[model samples]
Target: MNNTVPEDGEQLRAAVRERYSRSVGPLLANQPNSANSCCSSDCCTPPSTQDVRDTTSTDCCSTDCCSTSQADPITGDLYNAAELGTLPIAAVLASRGCGNPTALAELKEGEKVLDLGSGGGIDVLLSARRVGPGGFAYGLDMTDDMLAIAERNRQEAGIQNVQFLKGIIEDIPLPNDSIDVIISNCVINLAADKGQVLREAQRVLVPGGRFAVSDIIFQGQIPPALRSDLESWAGCIAGALEENVYRQLLQQAGFTDIEVEVTRRYTLEEIAAGGARASIAVLNEEERRQTEGKFVSAFIRARKPAKQV
Candidate 1:
């Protein structure tokens, strides 16, 4: 994995798009089914934590590849067993979210919800069920393969009130003040311009609408070298803003009652155990120690103030 961040805006966006596009192919091929056939005859069974540490040659940043082992602790055990059973098998298998936003978003009946970076439509399907037939759900994603899979999952689940749109999170395609609630799962940290993403979220939300998401957040400063790594950025590390900075950005984007609640914190030992050794491989022992307890998966909540008369 390349360790250097792309300095050019367009270049960075292209890099992210290409990485995700390549990952979707393998993920789609590996979707679990009744036959339980492997993606390939030579496919190794799902890897364990030790297996991930032993295999240092693979690109640990590739979501499709590394996630097959379930070594990335950030993405697992988010939804409960019953919740997983309710969605299409493909949706359940394709989910890569860090947290269960649908569970925490407190969705209500007859509400209109939009999911940013709605990979595989897991949250959208879940949200659709929560909001019921009287409500609607919209999923927006930039990757064609993910969108395709999400749409297929929606059809398979026989859901009628959900729609998927292709677009970047920084520039939502919805009209202003159109959404009742906005939700996302671990996808915001992948954006190169988070402030813009928040602004767009605020723009499309109705006054008093809620902003609820599960995302990576940092508590302390990360070394500049780590922050500049392209792999770290793609893996939801380098792009994570410190908790205070994250809250400030939300306030700057015109959101109020900003609250960032920590859901899970990652220790350095856990990182090495979780198949992200590549991210820490460059760090010296002391630098690695500095990272302990600094990174967290947070449930961020904020609101767009009600419209004034």
Candidate 2:
């Protein structure tokens, strides 16, 4: 139903670029319309920027990337507590994530935090407060539009300890072992080379530093047609590495204590509502049914071994 992999990747990237560019203007004003939130959908058309906060759908996840506390897998303790009230409006508005890294990261006060694929700086802004004036946060994104929006957010928030860098995750612009913690939200699966992402996460982090991310991980092998589907890739389903493979890749990259925890699985209806079928025809009945409600979004936590002398 979908085109080959390369085609999907390009389309997804384009959608991301366009959506962020459009949302940038709204983000700077700090009166963001929730409907404008951009995710893999500009590629997959998942939840609109605004639809992410629907209590009936997203449930416990706040649009604010700052809420990092743990919650029940089924009963939804995380959703009920809503422990992330400390974030700035910019953060809540710019958030385009599936999980909250701030809670999962277990960040200490004054430790440096780096957000890969920082987007409009939702996680970065949230992390800035956690680290306080003694600590710093760095948001790295490849999109110039996103970087500009982040900078505006930084200025508006009056946060001096945060900086935005324009770059990709596979080849980060930061120095070696320069960060104390790394956090990302639904961004890593988008990279063309996830291994390089793991490697870079290791390279930039100090020994014992943690990699906390909220991403989509597959339960099993995705269909070849879906795997090669660029729109699906952008939508965050196609490119997802299986759970076991993700753990293995982390270990191979010298990360330890790896944890891949599944939190939610999207229904076929949800996927279709979010626009996951945009690139291909929703023609095949089997394809439509197979894709319905099958993707899982989870929090991924791992650590780089303390430097070995």
Candidate 3:
């Protein structure tokens, strides 16, 4: 994967915003039987932005605003039956996560948690349940449509300790050192400025706070053509960082104990997109093969220093 994110920041943002906005129909419609990912032909859903999202839960889907890939390579089987059973079908369906950050985060009974790019509030609601009444969970997302879906799901779930905020991950609205733990689900990789995002995450967490997230990262080389494709970026595949770069960024952001553990490798066939006009079309069979083992889902962990230097 490339080290630099797409330079056209506004275009990237617009690509993301448009994709998620169209998803409003199926998301709020509360369609029965949840899809594995937000925008998949598997479930006949529209373009996805899981977490409202930073993508691909979403580092969410869509290489084209109206088109989608053949499989949800980054989403699926992250949530357990117990977790799924506890949430609304829409919330479960709207989930755009690469991993269950809440489960891996090991949230305590009284911890303030923040979910950057908290799409439909799945992690937020779950965190509220874990943190209990004394603690709180805040879900931040840039898409109002996704926020509406989150709010609807929140009301349906009847969980009181959670609030969904409207904002992007790069510029979190909360005060500095105001949070206990920071979590994101496959969303950070979607940001055009991942450095700023990590910095903001660092800024908001209390000293000694934790950073646990599920995201898509690369282990090896990515085609230069793919890196330049803005649509692939919107779909989550184009914008991810190599694992080493991810660790370096965290360290530069004043984090310690950083770790990037791969959970799954996306096979070549799984990355196929049926849509003729989809963004992944840039990758022919050879390009797809080159990408086979390079792309992976990872659980990244880091902690802010006990005292900032």
Candidate 4:
């Protein structure tokens, strides 16, 4: 795999840790409390469009796709319990995902699962319940604050079958071929070395074990100017890889049946305005138009092909 860890990788990692640590706990808590309220995108307005024609769904394209979107803090159907739901909301508030991992993972009862960058324990809690008493779920993340939040959530939810570990997705802290499924959400792009991340994911999964994730993927090349802007990169736009690159990376990592399904596409305006805060909105008119409708969020699925020949 290419060693593309930018010289700024360490700095970027620090920035990410600091940023998410401060805001994530509160953000997850607010998700269910403010169901219809504008998510992170409510903070900024996207650029006005003057194109001849428009062609994207408002649901598929957030007005400000560049910003972080709050997750459904409650584990799927689990927090519905009147007693559990009434507990201090931390358990329900640990999710930071774009798509529902439980739904895509197709997890079976008693199957082992691993969640990469499992923030706030949202997906882990849900997965644990899905696997029932026989299955187990493990969450791995590098941020101490995130792990703390997740641990709190796990305790609050009384989910004994799940385990939280401190680790990077690019260098997982688990035994190889031990997990039956892997899931992640909107976290992979934040890595400076996605190639290493995928390889690590492949290394940890059992044969035929599933890999399902939701993340941002560029439809084509992002201009050089946009690529280097750290704010844009951290906001999940500039650092995105092209769709083909996603496929190639997974294939190269020994994953099979790679699928890069575009769940939603974001126009340039959408991404720039995503978190409702964009440092890139300063671009000129032509530059703005050049990038319209160029990015997407996808539900990617692949498998560690059942013990290759």
Off by over 4 Å in 3: 1-6, 32-41, 44-71, 273-289
Q: How do these models rank on lDDT, best leading?
A: 1, 3, 2, 4
- Error (Å) of candidate 3 at residue 24 is 3.4
Q: RMSD per prediction, one decimal?
A: 6.9, 6.9, 7.3, 9.3
TM-score of 4: 0.77
Number of the top-ranking candidate, with lDDT as the measure: 1
Worst 10 residues of 1 by lDDT: 34-43
Residue range with the least summed lDDT across 10 consecutive positions in model 2: 71-80
| Tens-digit lDDT string for candidate 3 (1-309) | 332334677767767776666655566665432232333334422333332322333212323322344335566567665666678756766767777899999999999999999988889999999999999999999988889989999999999989899988989999999999999987887898999999999999999999999887888777776676655665566778988899999989999999888888876545443111244566777876777778778899999988837
Instruction: Estimate the TM-score of every prediction.
Output: 0.85, 0.76, 0.83, 0.77
Note the Cα lDDT for every prediction shown. Answer: 0.77, 0.67, 0.74, 0.66
Clashes of each: 0, 16, 13, 12
1-309 per-residue lDDT for model 1 (tens digits): 555888876678777667666555665675332111101111222332223233443333223444554334566557675676677656765665778889999999999999999978999999999999999999999889889889989999999999999999989999999999999988888888999999999999999999999998888888776688776676677778888889999999999999888999888755444334566787888888789888889999999999799
Instruction: Compose the digit string of candidate 2's lDDT tens values, residues 1-309.
Output: 434565444455556555556655555554433332324212111122323344333322333421322211211222112333444445444555667777778888889999998887767877887888899999988778678777876787777899999877889998899999999887887777889899999999998898888887777656566676555665566677888889999998999998888878876644433334653354367766665555678899898889678
Expressed as tens digits, the lDDT of each residue in 129-178 for candidate 4 is 88998999999988887788788777877778989999888889888999
CA shift of 10, model 2, Å: 8.4
lDDT (Cα, 0-100) at 162 in candidate 3:
90
